[model samples]
Target: MREATHDPATPLATGLSPAELRLLLSFAYTGAVAGPWPAVLEAAETSLRYQAWGLLTLCLDVFTRGLTPETGLDVLAFAVAYGLAQVGRVAEDYILATFPSVVATPAFLDLPAHLLIRLLRSDGLNVLHELEALEAASRWLMANGNGQEDLAKEVLSSVRFALMSGRELKKVPSVAAGVADPKVLRELMVESLAPMAQLPCRVRSLQEVLVVCGGDKLTANLAARKPSRHLWFAHRYLSAVGLVKRVEWRALGHFPDGPRFRHAVAVVGNILYVLGGKCYYGVRDTLASVYRYQPMDDSWERLASMTCGRSYFAAVALGDFIYALGGSSGEIYCTDTVECYDLTPAFPCPRRCQPLPMALCGHAACALDGTLYVSGGCDEACQCQASLLRYSPGEPAKLLAPMNGQRAGHIMEEAGGQLYVAGGLCQRDGQTGYRDQLAFEVYSPKLDIWVLLSPLPHAHVAGGAAVLGGELLVLGGYSHETYKDTHLIHAYQPGTRRWITRGTLPHAYTDFQACVLTVPPALQWVPPVVSGNPPPPGYMP
Candidate 1:
């Protein structure tokens, strides 16, 4: 196979062939037309290797004043059929600019339903909610395109997209009731909006804090742009502890023009940072951009570029430092490259921290006392890691603790002056007899020993762990198989030394960072208002 040339004659390198060129017509120019009625866009409707629908819609304005009512309707018709977006404001401006009485016609109704349906599947509600005319068009399809499978698909897609809106839709209440069933919403949002497949995977760095205060708070920018994804993971941890008033939906692509940050996440005071994960550079290649989310401003700021461009790496923050631990650049491989940024105000520079002793990706980390602890990561050999290393802020990390057996993809919690490692592959040697490899163990920092705790009522690894009400609450993660498994959340009580299963997470919110946030006792109460609700909100207050 040959690569597509650096030639305008060919836009794609492979996949679609030359014979497909029949889908399009020669480009026509009608911008100068001052005749009776709407003019047609000149860009070809179709071309080999792709659809030129976007460029054509752009021409709708460049050529027609969009004042040409019939021409505007035609472009909208094509856009609705192929699910084209981002052209509405310009196109509408043209429609009013042309200053004609625009009306919907039979051709508009006859357009393929797939585009309208696909539009519904757009991310957040930005595209979908913006499509007032298109949504109305889809409703027409549902009522008129009823018996046809194509029409039914548009109806279903719109319904699915509307439910995904995460905001209440007055028009679709009954449909929302059926689809918004806590059981269903979480399943729809796990995958990203990017038309890509599992670009390897990595969880964000989240600290488990105990907040006795009540109400649910969104984790700053964890899913800042896509609250739907945040809501799916938010419920289990946020509502469990009562730290937010609600999972607000202000997080829809707030950084629409910001640099791309894929497969990455970071947590600072009230800010969430997302770095290079996977952004489409070519059809298959991923982007390497970084973004920062500020919770207070509800905005994302672009940050320093990564020294080494990579995605799918685990990130952890200890003290004023944030670290991108390990992950791959592209291939299904593992890396131990570490890049960290010191947020110290006087003079901050990002440099490589000590690399992991082994290449551990898809791992979890927790900070305790003064040391950064990491555990339960899988390696290149596809082996679970039982090795635990503690990184001192200024000094080198020492391998003070080794788990009882091979463990990976499990949760780690540091509480009450002890390190609790549970729900990983705690392999047993012949010394302990059991056909199964599922169990948990706790490391005593004081006694310098590993003690076996109660086994999970059901086996789980790579789950989420947070210390809430003095118990370790473990949420959604994969079992031995299936990354999409969501069933029960196991709560382990350290005092009673037992495991009690709680409600299942909405879905498998596996392997992502889960934090238990709390306002410190000192920061808990705000000073009352000196002059009717003029309260000072802060630790100083």
Candidate 2:
């Protein structure tokens, strides 16, 4: 095999068109392909044909990032054909995330039987009910007609028909007619609902783990706040005798170096990047250090520090770069400076982006649809802000509708295309001091409006917030009124529009980072069920 040439017109031994040859050669040389998705797909196929693993990887990344409801099936099929398991997994996740919309797309009708089977078999399918999954499969079968009887039988085994209730199961016959024999479907339903023999438990996919990282911890004796270096993640959930619910947590070793708080963390692919923050209580203790952790290897590597040390700032990963926005820095304290670090470049350093219209600290931020949204932080004057600002590189930050009220030290996370803000400090009743903000609010980007949601049952100030299992989780943070840290985790499900206690952390922790990482299967653990009962009401953790 020979390396591709720089010449645009050069013909390769491969039967790709001139345009595709150029696209492949460009990716081989400059590591970038410029064209529509169809052209890129052609080049990707060419890379696979020629055993060009590197080019194929780049193509896979493009496919992964470009995935939408419309393009997910195509990407999944391509990834499966190329034996790119990781890309296929990501495509599967995207498809599951937008399953309802994906099923409505024209591509859904054209999905091959095997690919449809692969999707239906996933435990992570984000369907509201098993019946919806049945409906999707039935639609596919009806479109392809009776020739897919084998596919229908496969769908029967692939779908979790047992998860449906008696009333839900009644609808199975109508859906099963084209996909599988009606009588056989009934038998599966019966066996699944109640089996004489013990069967393997069905749990949601553990492809990603929810990790709680460095935070401030309060000792048992009501002692001083100490920054912790501990790292732990939820290993498994237990269903014990007497309906006891417990979540087992496992340690994944400490983050390299000492503990810090007010730091910003973000996940790019499977890697976790821990950014600048304060190492200790002193204002001078702010750090410019940066490091990244690879969950698969349980290892960490220090990266080039930011241009300036920052604390109480927001860091979000957007596209190929990480943006460190308004936070308290050395000398100036609260500064409006913003920096962007390119993850693709070796030895990357921070590049300045358009600064916020005003300085912010104790603020929270998250990325959605490649745009960065920041809200609820204090200015240098120490006045809380309710302004919602939208930012992008090379563009002036635009302020949208403000929050219901001023807040700081809050947690802002994006779930289902909307931004959710909860647990913050805010002034009320003309009081000089700040109190916990319990009123939760959500922002709609499309309408440019903010509306209130049910307030957190408990105040969550300065806690770690992340979306896991399709719910917004508020991890350990101290309430402003009590001045005590909590280890309990609270989850807000969008469907129910209510908050429920998920579980507790290994210990009382606050001011820490929370983000999900894709850990290798070797590091995952599922403990045996224990004997106990549910935590009593008003029980913390």
Candidate 3:
């Protein structure tokens, strides 16, 4: 290979150490094609106090490889001071990706104000429980404020105190003690006392994840026992690096009432509205009872019942109302009737609305742009239908363009201003009759069109599905051959146009409902509290 000459006229060339100068010459010779340039740049800055623009450009090429964990913080400080925002952001991403390791390091509290603010504003910071973020913010302010109350207030403003638990908010002054301005502290206290709706810092949509509800399962002692059933809530958190972890299935206290399956769940604000479903296995007995679950307080309360019992229905929250569309009622396999529940405190009962033109069951529904879209369900005849339906508040449902394939027990969700349907049961060749479906399709309301995208890795039906972090997560369903529950969890990445297995559910489950819930700001992972004695001070739960 031909040797390349370094441009001595390059900025700060004279200040470069021998190692840095060699790397710089290589960068110049190869037109900045190199590996591990961040290491080279770090050495250059540490020894020679020089930042070669060429070397920085090379570093960008290997950004995806990530920075060494030990060097990430130092590089971030250097990047910020040099006004290399793009580089700083990459460094910050690395640091945040390994947040659990860095969170306890003293360097976390010593980060410059600008870098701290940038990390706090990131949606990826959801990896840190809100309380941890709060503590880090307080420590940083206390360390860097230097008795400047105004600067302390400015730094504190970036912390989402409204999302913290009421108990944590009460200790804010003690946590921030000598650094926080009394006036600002008083304002925070007053704000914490206000109703949750009025709080300025609520959980953002990206921080939310799908919570899977009750399902059926076979017990370990299978010889003489019937299949076991459960009424619990399953939740998981995705790391900043897109790895799903900490899958938990927690019981909603004891199910003194009964077990439910094939139900419908809708979230309006912080409350979960769980609607009707069958009470037992192989029993025609259905329910009209409704319950509201508040995760913040870990409490459940009974709500007004629907006009009639329903199961395998499509429910969606649009505006301030919850709409229950066509589904089976009692012995009837299907019903065309629709009902709307006014969520306003004055009228909590579900009232009859204009019925669907035809009955539907095992369908999916989602709200978008003040309209409700229903897709892929079996008709009253029990035949899979590809028909798509749209409904407005006072308007009767209208049929839109049919889907590319008939689907029932599929998943439908609205994302990026489009509607996506994936995995279901569809009629196959005459020899095969009906079979599980792997087909996927997208609909654009603006264009009035349907486009088939990549298919799922395998056929799935009755899976819990939701959009999290701008990707589609399909969890725990079954196929035709097995006829048993599946623990698989698959994620569809639009950028890659492929399906990747993210992680498995804690248990195999089917016939369950899933919806995203914004975690309470003050929620922590804490051990069980014993009676009488108070929890240890500052202990996270």
Candidate 4:
């Protein structure tokens, strides 16, 4: 028998071996641990079992950073056993994102049935076709379904058979009949033949959700417009009879304060940061207040305010900080001040950064390859700008080749490793007057050139843009030509080089911001209901 510590101050290690106790003590005092793979895992297990939270957290960090295709399934099992929700979520996401490749690994066959079902049930599962999901389920059953008939039925049922084509459906019985009850399989096959419009199963799952926040809409009675504090996100889409499709949008609660528009929004990790914007219609109502929405709790927290009030500005998250660039500061004209918030701090305050060379507003900005790129906005003189500028902290802005034409209130986003600028008011060449720009453009960083693409079917100004599932989406914005807000959503497909209508917002919303988020399960499972209920007459987006 080994002797125990006699000192009262020395904490006793009840469940840990001598090696694990040493590893834990070292991590406790130095915030780091090291050992062979087996010993490290043992330390992690002891840390969690003994409630050494700090050491456990460090272990999780190491595990997450070290995850690979071979070790990902093991991480999921460990996370589930230790109640490490965040780690489990990340591992599951990795597995789904690389499903095709991950499925080939031997570790995948060893995945427990409970975990397999959880992955299949997620809306975030990434698959090019329903057959892929069916294949995965079949493989799992062949490996693990030996005597677990009920479990086999549940796993097979998780695959969305309705989304599979007739040929794909035919293979289901051949693959699943050996494991699941033949009677149950027959009913599923019958159900899949019904018209897709009538079927309840969603056609596909989305890993990234598009969240539209804080835009203005015409109030009831049509007397005046009111800003909306409501936050909405599309969770699923249902297709009806030919050419008719509807989106399932649900509320993710509301923003803090009253309501805001002409503001800026950015997402770092899963946290949403809502920055300065006017709360009301007053020209001078610009806000410096900052708030963040935590999806973990569906809660909002007010962070340190910006140094200057701004609206019609651009915000982008880079590294550990969110940069708030040029916009109007409730002044007679826009301002060129720029600031950033260090997300590392609990109560992060804005830190001053090098200002833009000229005052600009209604512009669009995106961070690409660690550098900031700003394009197409109005200068202080109220003149639309065609210039593109590259900027970095503490350094003067560098001007690049200007766009083919001037624009403002447009959207700029990075997709497929390049930047795309579209939809804003643009000056017609040689004309003193300006019109809504239907023709969009793309910028190539390697060649440093801007090339015009096909024109949009309709124009959008002050619209929100986000990249979801590798597609560039332009959300609700009022048309400069018609001077009316639109609820329609347009997505640009790079493969076809065409713009396709994805769906519409619940309301005609403009001057808002949209970001792609991997919503927490709490918010994702909120029972999606079709919103767009006939707005009491005269409801403008």
Best candidate according to lDDT: 4
TM-score, predicted candidate 1 vs. hidden true structure: 0.45
The model with the greater lDDT, 1 or 3, is 3
- What C-alpha lDDT do the candidate models reach, one value each? 0.48, 0.79, 0.70, 0.79
Instruction: For candidate 2, give the lDDT of residue 456.
Output: 90
Candidate 4 per-residue lDDT, tens place, 56-173, comes to 7777887777665667788889889878889988888777755655676788899988889988887667665666787888888888888687887788778877666556667777
> Where does candidate 1 stray beyond 4 Å?
1-266, 275-290, 309-312, 345-349, 425-437, 482-484, 518-541
TM-score of each: 0.45, 0.65, 0.60, 0.66
64: Cα error in model 1, Å: 73
Answer with 2 or 4, whichever has the higher TM-score: 4
Writing each residue's lDDT as its tens digit, candidate 2 over 1-541 gives: 3443345466556566677666666876788777787877887888888778888778877887767677788898887876888898888888875676688788899998878887888866755457778899888888874765566667767777545546667777876665677766777676665553113435344466789888888776766778888778776543322322356677776868899888999899888899988889887899889998888888988988888999889999998899999899976769899998899987667888888889889999889988999998999889888889988888888989999988999999987678999988998667788888888999999999989999898877888988876578898888889887777788886645778676778778878889887766645532222235454222223
Model 3 spans > 4 angstroms off: 1-117, 120-207, 221-256, 520-523, 526-541
Residue lDDT tens for model 1, 81-111? 4455545544444333221123233333444
Name every residue pair that clashes in candidate 2. 152-179
The number of clashing residue pairs in each candidate reads 15, 1, 6, 1
Lowest summed lDDT window (length 10), candidate 4: 532-541
**lDDT score, residue 473, model 3?**
78
Candidate 4 overall Cα lDDT vs. reference? 0.79
The order by descending lDDT is 4, 2, 3, 1
Highest TM-score, which number?
4
Which TM-score value belongs to model 4? Answer: 0.66
